[model samples]
Target: MVPWSLWEKLTTAPWLSINAAGQFVQWFNHLLMLIPFGAVIAVALGISLIRRRWWSAVAAVVIPMVAYSLNIWELFIEQLGWWLLIWLISFALCRTATHYLMLSTTCLKIANRCQFFWPLYVGLCSIVIFHPSWLVGVASALIALIPTFICQRLRLFAQLPSKPLEQAQMLGANKAQRMQWVAKRWLTPRLQNWRARTLQQSLLYCAFAGMIGLPGLGQHFYQGLSQGQHAMVGQTILTLLLLQLLLWSIDHAHKEVL
Candidate 1:
């Protein structure tokens, strides 16, 4: 069994300082990591909103807001406003992209087939890129996510009954018109379930990217393990478990709402 003094030293040593301000600053820096972490869910929520999944959107927004309310609220109120703006921008961008993709069969086909070798692509990029930067992390995460996104979209597209497209075509609807009509009538509704699942999967991928230098809990956890900092490792594990619980609650709430 560990002595109380030793446990205290283990837990507090990382933040121990003679100056109070310095200790506070260290804590603040650690909490700042939540911004990007929360942004993942925010971006996912934005995409879900674009796909017209209102319930999942609500869950996504509320879960993070509640989960990090204590630590993140005091970190930067103004930055929260910036995040909201970012969410709005993402919403507009996704909506426009979806509109354009629906209008162009060539673009849709390209998107479907472009990332066929995503696993190889991710591995090659990770191997070649030795330096760790936010750009590298973002690029890696996006590379891994794009294929999953396309597959989810295609799966939804397949489940769509052919009757609506056929009916639209029968009425002399052009290719674009049929595509748009089917998208609105069928694809959007079915997208809610998959969007929620995708958001969960995206969180996992984002966390995994931390091992490759993505900032946040995962990165800190990896560093702690490498440095043999038991306290830091334990803290990160606890934080990650809390995060997982929050996500599960959000997912459960989303299911009930549906």
Candidate 2:
């Protein structure tokens, strides 16, 4: 058992957040890694599911999406064009994947698609791919999305009414049309259900980023631990746990409200 004195430091308050001005900035920085991945998924869904054409969806999704760069502090205009270009490329890739999923007749065909195979191949071949702290952090959050998306498929099967598809078919809607007009609306609500998990994933990645000093609570925790500042570590962890609880409550309330 640890002595009381050994545990004494844990009782002190951490002053890390006392400077209110930088707190929000720090919080946003922590979530930066998650923003692009979220954008990809959101764009893919909005285009392929709702609008039904990946290319047409590009102009709509991309134009409004440039707004994300506005969230970047102090150089919103100067760096906006570069960020827009990055978003454009990322969305194009994601939309291509959406097309693959939309067009594939069989699961086997999707399994054989190039996107999954090649990125994973490149990710594996480049030894340094997983080593960079920034890369790993982003990858962890994106990986967390895998199970969530799978669950969405299962939820869709259970929740979708076959009668609607039959009605759409009788109304002369093609397979793609029915999926776009009917399935898309049904699937959109499922987005809300993922909020809790997304927050959980974001926090997990933030902690991961902290391992390499990526300017988040994770980094703060790492510093506190290295410096033997148990009190600060305690403060940071408890705050994150509280944030997690807050997110869960918010998600639940959102569902209830909807």
Candidate 3:
């Protein structure tokens, strides 16, 4: 009779082959789905940058959305962390921009800003007080955006005048202006920082989750290693590396914009 270990391996070989084939098919389907959407987004961004025409903007947006009927991009992004990365990058960049504003305020206030500190602190602290949920997160994001958009609209965040402008003339001194400034300076920066840090944190979380048998790329990678799918594992690793590079490029572009 064949050795027990050899027999088990032989028995499972076909199953292993099937699973690998499935994974390859999934990856290819994902690429096919995204390539068109990616192309359209790229084109729209170009036209928007160039012609600045609303119609082009709408066309750029409306045409590629035809992909949504296929829903492949959604599936790929759901598994791939692309959406998460975008959220995090946006949050990080905003937070970084706010840091300078906060620092400036700290010096300028010289005890004056302390009056508003408690409310601001309380508001921000509340976000971290509970376990995160999608509903709560979305509400919080909208609340944050209200002030952010206001600040951008009013140009409340342009650099302070070189010479000390009169406090009375400060654009952001009014209640509305202050709210806008605070939201722009604090909210986006805070969110962006949270996003970037959380994403990096998730690599660890996903690994730990795998150790506990949670399902994800981590679990799949683990299974691949156990079953000796060296090529499959290698491809997964390569895919992860490519994703990181893509995220890095996006961050670099956003940074340049900031």
Predicted model with the maximum lDDT: 1
lDDT tens per residue, model 1, 30-106:
66656665665665576566666666667666655654653433322323333334444544544465567667878
Q: Which candidate order results from sorting by lDDT in descending order?
A: 1, 2, 3
Candidates' RMSD to native: 13.0, 18.0, 17.0
- Residue 55 in model 2: shift from native, Å? 32
lDDT of 3: 0.43
- For candidate 2, list the clashing residue pairs, or say none: 210-219
Candidate 2 Cα misplacement greater than 4 A, ranges? 1-92, 106-150, 153-161, 164-218, 230-258
TM-score of 3: 0.31
Better of 1 and 2 by lDDT: 1
**Which regions of candidate 3 are displaced past 4 Å?**
1-215
The count of backbone overlaps in candidate 3 is 6
Instruction: Give the per-residue lDDT digits (tens) of candidate 2, residues 142-258.
Output: 554454456545445545544466778888877776766566566655554443333233333233222222234444556677799987666554544433332233233332332
